[model samples]
Target: MIFLLLSIICSVTVGVLLKLAKRYQINVMQAVTWNYLFAIGLSLFFFKPDFSSVSFSLISPVYIALGILLPIIFLFQGFAVRQAGLAKTDIAQRLSLLISLCAAYFIFNENFDRLKYVGIIFGFVAIVLTMYKKQTSSNNKYSWLYLLLVFAGFGVIDILFKLVSQLNEIPYTTALFVIFCISFVLSLAYILYLAIAKKTKIQLINFVCGCILGLFNFGNILFYLKAHRAMAENPSTVFAAMNIGVIIIGSLIGILVFKERLSKWNYTGLVFALIAIVLITLSKLHAV
Candidate 1:
């Protein structure tokens, strides 16, 4: 669907922008903090989320958790791409589907046929291969932690979003607004702390970059949710499409646009990623 395609493009664009930010010497932390500001503004202006419809009596804990978690993981992602490479960080984030798929089976009690089983198992091999590199930084000893955090953080966030979506009482836009508002508060506080305590100067370029990032970031979520709603009966279809598209585009951008190198093992992992997506999607089709 067009929605899924747009979501994938927006997601990859965000990664590419972050990668470019490092080279441009932009203040990523400041930009990210302000990104929440612009995202909140965009949500209010376009979505115009109804707050009166939301009540504490029917509050979802998932929303509360995401408010803080979203910004924290966002910062981790920036760190991941900057410290590791774009392709590596992109794979880590996209591979989060592995965790979500496992959760769906064990925790959510979703059924998976043999095809899904094969796909899930193959994803692990892809992850190990993706992490392999010919020559990493001397900082490789601990730097991988950033990429690992991005992987786990996004998985947990996806789980929380699913939980929120399942609740019929909570309007999705309202929940999103609440989450963004909390993220804005936390991010703004951090920015203020840096200004007062660390004396880090906030630059206009940060807000400029934040505005651009916010448009794509908001579009990513908007289109993703729309795609899911359009294909509600077959979520795996959207999931497979989104992950595969990001992995493919992200890899291409990193390799061609950014001139980032990947080892043979990494390329092998990418091939496995495509296979996993096919198998997973086929399992959904078979179920249907």
Candidate 2:
């Protein structure tokens, strides 16, 4: 429970930092690139994942793909924070569980329980309501397209992580390390592309901000995994708490600290999200 709370805090902090980056007109791409660099180092120092047993043929493809995908989605997340603000972005990210739920039922051959079906229905409604933005004139209206991209990209990422986890021959930590390494290289490629095009130069401020991001980002995953292990008897609890906690805390931060205004419809959508999550957890009650 403690681990889960810490994980939620770290998750919200990542978004907050990205949101704050807007004040300095921080180069989000550069910050994300440095985020990967530092993330790889932290993974090495803390996890020390051994690569000796890695079967490249079986594991390499997935890790390489994740390497590309993670950084890309992270860039989307940065854009969403700046474009959509923290509240909607966080809800969209959490709503990705609905996609994963569908994948699990269709591709993974999981039983489609009644509660989860209702949860799925509620999830769709939640997406529409949470993304509702009243007419505005700041020319800063939330980009629903970007928010949807965040939703789909994260859902795909989660499904891929499930695949990697099922491959018991490869150590989970080792696979994570390889993915981080690949993400680092991919991000660096993007940075170099910018430099060659005379688009922008790397700045120290990016790294300064990125280092803070790296610590909390890594902490989020670390604490989440720990929470799962700690609550192995109730894996569904971890899943529900992690998603719902992020929503509740993230919304509070956005509303209270950032002073982002959410419409009544958006508030209604958050209520629906909670109900959807509860239904999903109820569905898993018997399975675990």
**Top model number, TM-score:** 2
Could you give candidate 2's per-residue lDDT for residues 132-152 as a string of tens digits?
776565555647777888999
Model 1 TM-score on a 0 to 1 scale: 0.94
Question: For each candidate, what TM-score against the reference?
Answer: 0.94, 0.96
lDDT of 2 at 243: 93
**Cα lDDT computed for each candidate against the true fold:** 0.86, 0.88
Estimate, for each residue in 1-288, the C-alpha lDDT of model 1 and write its tens digit.
Answer: 999999999999999888888889988888888888899998998789888888887777788799889888988888878777788889989988888898999889999899999998888888888877645457655547887898899999989988888888867888888889888898889898999999999899999999898889999998998999999988878988898889988988889988888889889988987898789889889998
Count clashing residue pairs in model 1: 0
Per-residue lDDT for 59 in model 1? 71
Worst 10 residues of 2 by lDDT: 134-143
lDDT of model 2 at position 31: 88
Q: Candidate 1 at residue 136, lDDT? A: 45
